[model samples]
Target: MDVLIIDDDPTSVFLAKLLLSSTGLFDKLTTYQNPVDALSFIKVQLVDNQLPQVILLDINMPLIDGWQLLDALMPYQAQIQAKYWK
Candidate 1:
């Protein structure tokens, strides 16, 4: 599985990567401190191979908060949920 962690804090992102890695769940884990970059990644993901099985988003951030990100992802909700249903 692929995982995306969006957070401004380096320590939180690093800890999540460590814990998830220990579980042997993800093949690739990508972390983004900037929501703009993360949003760009998410947009490309819709056309790319596959979206992350899980996305860990922080509610707090400097630019483009998590809520905004969630709103941006709304259009892809159908596609996002479909993959996990199986």
Candidate 2:
């Protein structure tokens, strides 16, 4: 499984990565401090059929909060949900 973590706090990201890595369940793990960057990456991944199986998002981000990200992804909801259902 692939997982993507989006949070502004470096320590939180590091800890999450450490814990998830220790689980040894994920095949791929990615972290992004900037929600915009994460969104761009996700868009490309959607095209390549490499979307992350799980997205851990932080709602309190500065520029773009989790809600905003969800709204931004509204157009791709069907595709994203399809991947999730798989």
Candidate 3:
């Protein structure tokens, strides 16, 4: 499975990566400190068949928070849900 971590804190991101990596569950792990960048990456992934199976998002971010990210992803909700449902 692929995992995406979106958080502004480097320490948090590092710790999450360490913990998740230790589980040996994810085939791909991507981290982004900026929500905007994360959103952009997600958009690209949506069209590429490379979407993450799990998304660990931060509610507090500089530009786009978790809620905002969810809103931004609304247009693709069906696609995302279908991907996970499969």
Candidate 4:
């Protein structure tokens, strides 16, 4: 499985990666310190049919926070994208 984590905190992301890696639940873990960049990457992946089955996002960020991300993904609601927002 593939996992994507968007968090501004490096330590939180690192610890999450470590724990997830230890569980061996995912074949890959992609971390992004910037939510905007991460959202761009996610859109590309979705378009390319390579979207992750699991995504973890932080509510707090420098710019373009989680709520904004949810709004941006509203068009994909037919794909049930917002179900993963929490």
* Cα lDDT listed for each candidate: 0.89, 0.93, 0.94, 0.86
Q: Which lDDT tens digits does candidate 1 get at residues 1-86?
A: 88999999999998998899899978899999999999999889877847787899998999889999999889988887776676
Candidate achieving higher TM-score, 2 or 4: 2
Least accurate stretch of 10 residues (summed lDDT) in model 3? Answer: 77-86
User: What is the total number of backbone clashes in candidate 1?
Assistant: 0
Count clashing residue pairs in model 4: 0
Kindly give the stretch of ten consecutive residues in candidate 4 with the minimal lDDT sum: 77-86
Model 3, which residues run further than 4 Å from truth?
Answer: none
Candidate 2 weakest ten by summed lDDT: 77-86
lDDT by residue (1-86, candidate 4, tens digit) is: 99999999999999999889899999888999999999899888867778888889999898898889978978877655444444
Q: Give candidate 2's total backbone clashes.
A: 0
Q: Distance from true position, residue 79, model 2, in Å?
A: 1.6
Clash list (residue pairs), candidate 1: none
Q: lDDT: which is higher, 2 or 4?
A: 2
Q: What is the lDDT of residue 25 in candidate 1?
A: 77
TM-scores for every candidate against the unseen true structure: 0.88, 0.93, 0.94, 0.88
lDDT ranking from best candidate downward? 3, 2, 1, 4
